[model samples]
Target: MLDKIYVIDTNVLLQDPKAIYSFQHNEVIIPAVVLEEVDSKKRYMDEVGRNARHVSKLIDSMRGKGKLHEGVALENGGMLRVELNHRSFQYLQDKFVEKTNDNRIIAVALNLLLEEQTKENGRQVILVSKDALVRVKADALGIPAEDFLSDRVVEFNQIYTGYQERFVSSEVLTGFYKNNGIPIETLQCGILYPNQYVILKDTLRKSVSAVGKVDRSRSFLKKCAFDNEHVWGITARNVQQRMALDLLLRRDISLVTMVGKAGTGKTLLAMAAGLMQTEDLNNYKKLLIARPIVPVGKDIGYLPGEKDEKLKPWMQPIYDNLEYLFNVKKSAELDKILAGISSIQVEALTYIRGRSLPEQYIVIDEAQNLTKHEVKTILTRVGEGSKIVMLGDPKQIDHPYLDEYNNGLTYVVEKFKDQQVSGHVKLEKGERSQLAQLAADIL
Candidate 1:
């Protein structure tokens, strides 16, 4: 089939660099303005900057194969080129002179489409982006525009976090309680995925039931393994903790979403599981962790100092959990523990764009702070042999446009509820401390 020409947007590359590859055999067109925009972001020490650098490097390497301005063949059998079109609207430069960047990008797309239309057997030119307003403007201009569907989620309501409910016979319920165990093989009839918590209830009584999970070994609740030793000296104190452990340890449920109030141990449990899986079990090659840096109000502007220094405040929560898990007092001690484990990486979400990660355990904390588009971008980065756990409290969202029911975390839960590969748990009990729990409940 003849490849379609796709005009790549800066935001799309900023979200995922390999986005160019997502088009499969399609020809990707990167506007010069997009590269210029990416260049401006390349110096910052965040996910976006990192992505810009990555895309730059990718384009540079491709130059060895052929001219980047002309086009270069990708390993995936596709062409990538930088489009240099400054001709857009004649009045755009004067009317929206201040909005130079956006106008230039739109101009590139419009020019590409117009150029394509003049061809004898012209191919369609689609402007692919993660920016919504850009799409709106493209539509107004009669250009074919679309949100980068590679990161576009299945649906706002189709993402699942892998928890389910099932009705079992009274005998099964009685057996589960009496023996405190049930074989996985016997439960497979209703079990969805490993680590999925099942609310097994008696069909007749409806109330007689228990909640249990299928273990990593695909065995029933009776034979599942639970890491009793506290991760970094922190033990699972409650049923919710146990549930968290189950979710973390299970191999089949690659996507786990946990929602809870402040003291619910959501982040702690996630970190512990990440540590255990990445450090102890070596189930995955690395533990890649990140969270959106959505401030409560107006922007804080650019941060100063080295990458670690700038990220410290934003990553304090992750460090605190690590400190507790490693049973260390000093920051240096925790740093050493982290250093000893090369696979563990705590990064800002800003840098994760435009990278393809495989064989790693990823954790996105405070996910409620991310927009639907951002969440979709992060999830699509999951390659192979990877598990991504998104933990957050929807009610405590920091994103201005998002709310309890509309946030990305909730969106994932509602969307992927029926999928066999995902799982979700609403951590209810607050185990932080009496005061903290009280504050969480009353406040």
Candidate 2:
């Protein structure tokens, strides 16, 4: 078998600095233009900047092993090279601008393809890029391109939904309702994760059913404790919502992830549960609500105002849910009420990087916008007695580098599905309104 060569793109490294080591035993080519792009972004104070700096440090560290232009040995037994002589644009000059960074990167791959074809037994040279247009252009030039799949936890369709339906005997179903627990093996379901919910149905009677969750022991499927309970004047509108509430209210579970489409009540349910635990039950000291500031389309740039005033626009969705929970009609009145209580705090995820939160109910809304590293950093900040709920619709991600299967929310759901400290629920029904549901379905 011939070894393959993968040409790395700038956006791929910016999305994950460790991408250099992902292609095991394969020749990895980093076009010189990608380094130029990485250098331009290294001075900023964001995730991209950090990743850019990391990439530079990685390449620089390899200098001791060998010259990068000649090729250096990677830790994974792969060869890493910085292509310097492939700047020719003879193939793309007719179709694309010569000076653009993307075209320059594509030119390197095209030149490599031409060089490989001249050999008697040439290895396959493939372009790996996260950008669809780059891959499309590479295909037009007859170079194979693929998305970076190393960070993908699971395919979008195969992602864990936190629950599954199981068929059981009528006697088993009756025992589950009467005794509030049933042995997991009774249903012959194989290897259920701890905290995973199950819908039990009678074989003879389709309508007769019961909902239960796998206990921490993974030995029995126990009935949900808070399915019928109310939280901050809110009740679960569906089965998934009830499971979400149960997870949110559990003190044993440290992390809760809820994913759904728009109008599915992901944020509202999380906020309601946080408010109930923090205020009504007195289980936590404060309710910290936050979300990333990723916009749908073009950014409006910076706004001029105080921090809270500036955040009003980005944090309006959170405030809207709070207003509904508090039954407040005016924003000013809501501010006064929040200030008076002092326990409910609305914060931005930007400022949460360096702080340690203890005895707090932290709800991270729009978590789908966060990357895997960002989510890991946030989770590490959870001090003792803190419960963090990550809520987002994976399908509604606004982050350029994220998608339904690779975002932080989806990452956490898949990675922690089998852990006893975590619980997850994917809400299916939209509870917002008839019109809103229709829009989410059709649009």
Candidate 3:
């Protein structure tokens, strides 16, 4: 039985160009208007444009298999077809105009629905779109509509937090603190991933507590190497922060992801760690910091200056952190200090593509604004002996098409949590100030 027919929108294809074969053993339709929109975006240079071009190539390849106006057999045993000549304006119940792309797509679905009524057991025609407005309009017209789920993390809150609290007997706590390294498998807390942090608390003695991270190589729980170490006069305020610091300082871990809300010290801590590893320890050749040019509010328009000078405003937050770390008070002093330090480089993410970076400590701040493809592109730029840290608050995404579930930072944390070379920590407490913490909580 042909149980379902998926009418995919242009946004869905742009989001994931290989969506043509995702519906296993079901029929997939690309509305006529969607091709027009995809063709218009093929000449662009961004990720969306790249995906549009890829979709066009994919459709073109399928044309040799069979007529696209009829259908072609997908490798996944599904039928793929390009919808044409069913964009009737009179099919819509609403007063939707004809020239609009969204309305034309809806008309194609309406025609499909009407044709299905003549069959005894018609397949359910579901409109799959990434645009929420299109889904809402389809629902008003009694067509089933849903979001494309190829990259979405269902129930994103359930993702790994990277920290766990376990209550233990005072004897176990004593053993952990006395030996400084206990077999984590003996704790009987089930399986633990590499670099996962655990907090031990005494049930009888409420004040007694200890913190350790999982050492998978030795099958033990060991104390953090830099637990008491300070990075640029900054120390870890909590256990999660302590875990983050450990991950940052470790040479074996190449990728680290930190997620938290505002005032959680995510940015400040990452920058501090980057400076320590780059300037003090000489572990890396340089400290390269970049972020997507996402506007927090209204964009201030383009600034008139050289590339470095124009990047000053976009990277001012990083400069602010540097000044705080170096105990500088003014931008002039900070600029003077930065000019003297040849190891520090601040640039926008736009210029980072197709470049090789080796022996560097890279921090991509506000990384949640990046798409998964953008993240992959940035990561592929890393040369040998480089560590990349992604820092962001999933809840504060600024990209119009991204959210907590599908953004680059969240994607990295979820996809790499199981790797031995990757470490993640989701900081919860805000250390900016009491007032800022309260605002983050109640606001």
Candidate 4:
């Protein structure tokens, strides 16, 4: 097979700095304009800045062996080149302005496509980008373009739902109920993942059913802790919510991921469980609740106030859920309730970077707005005896650079599917209200 050449855009590098190494046995190109663009974003205060600095370090380390302008050899037998002189304004003069980095990148890809075509060197040149507009422009200009697909973990249909349904013989169902547990080998199904929830139905009579969790290490099908567990006056409204409650209330499962749509009780139930573990049960030292501060649309400027006052608007939804949990009627009373309980701490993910939370119930709400790296950092901050719960609606993400498949919550769910210490639940029903559920379905 002929080798291919891929010209990567700046956004691709920023989305994942190690993306250049993903294309196996293929030549990689980085336009000079992309480096300039990456340099400008290194001053950012978020993950983008961290990625920019990482890309810089990667390129700097490559410079020790050879000049980047004259291609360097990667360890995987691929060539890496920095295209320096492709910022010409000759291509797409009428359709696009040459002042932008996107245009410059397109120009680089166009020139390289022409050069490779003229030489007929048994290679195809394709432009790789994460921006839809850039790919559209490339298609219009007759240059081949594709999305960078390294970070996408799974398709929506292929994503693990953390629960499975299997039909078992009536005898097995009876045995499970009589013994309160069953040996996994007797089920006659394929091997199941650790911590995966399963619904066992009687083949003859589907009405006789049971829900259990697969503990592959112990080789047993233990009944889930759903029937008797209640969190902060909230009971499971459905089977999915019941499974989520089982994962949330378990001390053995250190990390939990919950993905659902609007009004699915993802955030509310997580906060309730955190409260139960921290306040009522005294299982943890504090209930630390936070969420990423991503705006829905164009951000207005910063609000003027102190820390708590500034966070009031961004964190109002969390406070609203707290009010529902505390049954407080007013803001002053909520303040008094919060003040009276030193076991709860309400904050934002912005200030959680450099702290080690020990014996705490950390609830990360709206976690779909976070990138994979940011989520990793947050999970690693979990100290001994701490439980971390991340819950989000993948369909309601506000982060511009993330999507349903590549968001951190989904990524963690997919990655930790088989691990013994991790558990995930996808709440399907919206239990908030009839109106909210209908609105989510149509609009």
Q: For candidate 3, lDDT tens digit of each residue in 196-301?
A: 8888889988888888888757388986555545788998888778888888889999999999989999888888999999988999999999998989878899
lDDT of each: 0.77, 0.91, 0.87, 0.88
**Where is model 3 poorest over a 10-residue stretch in terms of lDDT?**
90-99
lDDT per residue for candidate 4 within 1-443, as digits (tens), equals 42998999999999989998888898899999999999999999798999999999999999987999988988877888999876677866777865687888998888788777778464788999999999999888888999988889887578888888999888888889888889888876676788888899999996888899988584889876575457788888898898898888889999999988889998888999888888778899999999899987889779998999989988999999999999989989999999999988889999988999999999999999999999988999999999999989877888877888899988898898889999998888889999999998999
Lowest-scoring 10 consecutive residues by lDDT in candidate 2?
223-232
Candidate 2 shows a clash count of 0
On lDDT, the leading prediction is: 2
Top candidate when judged by TM-score against the true structure: 2
Give per-model TM-scores: 0.61, 0.97, 0.95, 0.95
What's model 2's lDDT at 198? 95
TM-score of 1: 0.61
Question: Which RMSD does model 4 reach against the true structure?
Answer: 1.9
Error of 3 at 46 (Å): 1.0
TM-score ranking from best to worst?
2, 4, 3, 1
Judge candidate 2 at residue 370 and give its lDDT.
94
Better of 3 and 4 by lDDT: 4
Model 3 quality (TM-score):
0.95
Model 2 residue 284 CA deviation (Å) reads: 1.0
lDDT of 2 by residue, 147-256 (tens): 99887879659988999998888888889989998888878888789999999889999998889999888999998766446888888888898888888889999999
- lDDT per residue for candidate 1 within 147-259, as digits (tens), equals 76555444454444345566888888888888777886676555355556666778999767677776556566752345554664567776567667776777877888888
Q: Which regions of candidate 2 are displaced past 4 Å?
A: 225-228
